[model samples]
Target: MNATDRTLAGLLSAALSDDPSRPLVTYYDDATGERVELSVTTFDNWVAKTANLLQDELSAEPGDRLALLLPAHWQTAVWVLACASVGVVTDLTGDPSAADLVVSGPDTLDAARSCPGERVALSLRPLGGRFPQPPEGFTDYAVEVPGQGDRFVPYAPVDPDAPALALPDGSELTGAQAVERARQDAAARGLEPGSRLLSALPYDGWEGLSAGLLAPLAAGGSVVLAPRLERLDAASLEQRVENERVTHTAA
Candidate 1:
């Protein structure tokens, strides 16, 4: 990211323009036996579709609160960026009762049911498929997102100073603030343009969020996010680092 880049969305735009074919997010879930890699163009497409679903279908606004009851997987990264694109405040704690919208995974269905506003559920299956049976009082994200335009045009201008992320600690930061913080953290972590970081952190707080997604983007780097890193043996992880050309590791 450059001096002019202020928000997470701007970082993505820069990445897409810089190298659309570069790998942006590579994910692995040992428990589910899932592995997926998304190039800059593909990641942007998913973000566009997800943003459309948030804006058009869920009526999400720039200042809306979105609780994500998801893990540190590829789809979660997509949702975070989508929220950033729409200027929505992403709450990782996923407290449904306090959010304007909640997107839940299979394990958190019951918790998400408590959310009073718009609720969407994902199967978190291969290719980010929809639930086999729709949850009550909730829309299926996979079913609705495909029809959204590949390109996203926000209906309103999102102020960079508006709050973009809310952590469970009751702390919040604007888009610009988050970007600045991520840049600092990225530098501290020795990430630079085109650097590939292999991260094994949950997406539950600022540290994890920064390492797994925001910081790398702010640094114009990519990530190989291991959601179940502890399950992978040392040899396996070493092989992964070699295969993915990981330049750094965050445990």
Candidate 2:
């Protein structure tokens, strides 16, 4: 990452510039036997679309708290970058009742209803499929995101010192701080450019965020996310590591 770029958005932009066609995130779901790989260009498109959805359609603004009630899935990673791009504060594993917007997975729909503002739901199906039947009071993310403009321009500039993430312990990390921490973690974990780090950590704390998403981005590497990794046998896990060309692991 460029030394002058102090935000996750900047890191993503740098990665896209460096190698747009390289794999950025590879997701595997052992339960469903599904694998999905997103190149830097494709992931950026998703982030741009989702950011536009938050800014134009949902009227989300800088510092607006968005409760992200999702797990360690590829879509969840997209939401994180989208929020960063829009300057919205992502509340990981947060309470829905206090948020201005809420994004939920299939298992968290009931909990997400407490939020009084906009609600979006992801089916967590392969290929970003929409829910078979739309959930009441929740916008289907798969339906809304596709039609959004491919390019995203924030209404205002994001402050590097402004809060970007709110952790479950009620702590906050500003954009610059998060980037710095990510870089530190990346170095500590021996991550290098083009390193393929496979992670099975849940997106609930700093460890997971650093290992699964931020560090890889900061280091200009790629991540292989294995959600529901416990379901995979030792042989299957080994095969996945070989197939993904994973150089490091954090489970």
Candidate 3:
């Protein structure tokens, strides 16, 4: 009965078909004081468009590792889902050597450039409308989202056992393993489609990549991302829990 029982592409196709009007994500920007909510239909379309860009613009393929250096913003969400749809390896890291393509904010560009790979750095500034000077050898993310249609050009089916992400501990897990872990957790907790989860952490690495991005999608739930915390304070976390109405919290 799980909605995400099919492949990531199938899960998205289901979401687009059945509950296109449902609110898939809600973005709350503390800096700009803006709130943007997207429905399932729009969310699916954007993911498809981003998938095309990753394959066409960035030269990403099913087995290639497309790194994501994004924060807990909307664009991060889009690329995470897009990578899943096409069976590309999405290795989330701040370290540029770990990725084939990197998407990030301005501050990390220096660190990103040092490692040297096929990088695709992006700006978070334009998302807020106060466009900062972009890093050299990067692309404009603002100009990238528009001008693409909603159709997801299907690719060859992927092996469920294929590696989808690389871990920091030099460990690699297959896509089936990832889905099984999520399924086990969800069944233990009685979770299903429409269940809400609060990502209580950053999405830049192994723990974040597994629990924050993949698990929620595998469980057919919306993942609510928390702001990057330089320091994790008890009181601040409690407030976030109350604000986000987090059904399940993972580190």
Most accurate candidate by lDDT? 2
lDDT scores for all predictions? 0.89, 0.94, 0.64
Give the winner by TM-score: 1 or 3: 1
Ranking by TM-score: 2, 1, 3
Return whichever of 2 and 3 wins on lDDT: 2
Q: Kindly give the number of clashing pairs for every candidate.
A: 0, 0, 0
* Runs with alpha carbons beyond 4 Å of true place in candidate 3: 1-6, 115-117, 126-130, 228-246
Which residue runs does candidate 2 get wrong by more than 4 Å? 1-4
Model 3: weakest 10-residue lDDT segment is 125-134
lDDT of 1 by residue, 53-96 (tens): 99998899999999999988888999998998988999987589
- TM-scores, in order shown? 0.96, 0.98, 0.79
Cα error, candidate 1, residue 81 (Å): 1.2
- Could you give candidate 2's per-residue lDDT for residues 48-131 as a string of tens digits? 999999999999999999999999999999999999999999999999999999999999999999999999999999999999
